[model samples]
Target: MKTTLKIAGALLAGWAGLAGAQPPAGDADIRHGRYLIQTSGCNDCHTAGYMQKNGQVPEAEWLTGDAMGWQGPWGTTYAANLRLLFQQVDEQAWLARARQPMRPPMPSPSLRAMSDADLKAIYRYVRSLGVKGSPAPAYVPPGGKVATPYFDFTPKNLPPMASQR
Candidate 1:
């Protein structure tokens, strides 16, 4: 009898935990999501060759992330594969991640400013695309050796600051 009670309790707990999971997004949500992604320029960096092709990349290839890196004072940061990232995390986790700051040239401020509905729509839209490709190369600190081709973002020849006066 005691064993039965414990099993029942565990089952109930599992069911309750699932209750908070996000539901499947409707067609409208997905469409809005696509719109947001395009308008917000997510494809520029996240999708390889997006800008080079003038946004002509196929939808199937969108947001898979790029091997290319952006190197600057902070470090080299690769755009993450949103599809794979979504697969690894639930909606709630995505929300938390979206709110956190990311190194340049990522626009973390734009993500943090988005409403929950907008964020959810973006998440749904990306997830709907399904996972493709492997994870991007890991971050390399400033001055670290980078194997992949990357854009040099280091500033050069800046004028002296007023504080130098």
Candidate 2:
């Protein structure tokens, strides 16, 4: 009888532990999303640029949405800080942006082809990164009869500087 009671108690304890052992679903999604965002290079557009402090780029400030160029045909274009934007921009918003026609210098070809699941994962990852407000770039449309050389829309034949090469 004592053995029986011991076995029964053990079983009860095991069941209680199992109940507590259930894995969390939210963590899995957030982790997966973070992996996809890093691989996708989402920061190339969404981050206005890295923040410069004392003329040096800080690693922590990366993906904070300061990388966006405001001088393109689109005026005051600031790459929405993906971290914050992801929270505000849902899966649908991301899907629409992905499907829209590609604008010059912004590469959407690969993103447009991504599966819906992938897009969601990417969005989730961006949101997890966290947001910091980036400076708004002044609007300068490319080559729109605008005389500013900085705004010239013409594709330069010169190879990108040594770093880009």
Candidate 3:
């Protein structure tokens, strides 16, 4: 009957659409990475004006690196431009580096604790942000200085502790 043919045609069309509707894993990974980055405070150091704007910067401008430098016994260190970093290295290399111990203020232990899948997602997401900005300033030694004012790491004088006889 005509009704049976119509139903069959509609069902076949629906099935065809479903068959071709697989979501890309890369997109899913990027979405997950975005969530992870936001929750894990990646923007705090990596994104310029993030703190000034209260984290309202556009996605395109995110992870472009900041002018603020962290100063310590190790000297001044700048936040690296993550977008450009991915362009320089492959995912495996990134994972390898992430596994290694990082310098001060970088929270290397937290990064190292991330699952490989999560790190891959982050790598994919940063790459998706597209290449932007040059590399951050190189590490400065203890006696060296940087153009930007950094958090000085000089030891503070303290009052002497009272001793019990």
Candidate 4:
């Protein structure tokens, strides 16, 4: 009987230790997402002047979106304000969208590589920030113009080719 009690106590102690090793669900998810966002350079374009400021923007101001647009053969695309985005959609919708193809410079491939849990954590973290800022400017198709200043897409000058003759 004493041996059985000792064995039970050992199992209980082991269980408690395992529980203590893991962080509480909500907090852990949000924190992990925040870490990923910071390390993955999400703020570089999502937050205005992030690179210029060397990432000094406060957490509250991060992911608020920017007016700077990326221009290329595809079109001009703007960085989205993540806080507003999460508020506008549920987790499943966001995940579905994240899986879809995105415009130039948005790194959709990288997003697709993330696990569902990481995506959920990102959703939770952005939601926790609360909604702020207006939606980013609409995308401009190739050969179209945008209201905001954008990265100019210019083709390199080349000499005439003999093949044309």
- Candidates sorted by TM-score, best first: 1, 4, 3, 2
Q: Report every candidate's CA lDDT.
A: 0.93, 0.58, 0.86, 0.87
Candidate 3 lDDT for residue 137? 78
Instruction: Provide backbone clash counts, one per model.
Output: 0, 11, 0, 0
lDDT of 3 by residue, 1-165 (tens): 999999999987887789545334477899999999998899988998897799999988999887788888777888899998888998889999999998777889999999999998998899898999877778887778588856666657856667732
Q: What TM-score does structure 2 among the candidates reach?
A: 0.55
Rank candidates, lDDT, best first: 1, 4, 3, 2
- List candidate 2 stretches off by more than 4 Å: 1-25, 48-60, 67-78, 143-153, 157-165
What tens-digit string does per-residue lDDT give for candidate 2 at 1-165?
999999999987887789435333366777777676556665555543322233244435545654334354443334555666566776778879877875545556887888877776666666666666654343444443433222223445768889987
lDDT of 4 by residue, 61-125 (tens): 99999999999888899999988988989888998998999987888899999999988888888
lDDT string for model 1 (2-40, tens) is 999999999878877895655569988899999999999
Please say which candidate is ahead in TM-score: 2 or 4: 4
Which one wins on TM-score?
Answer: 1
Q: Using lDDT, give the best candidate's number.
A: 1
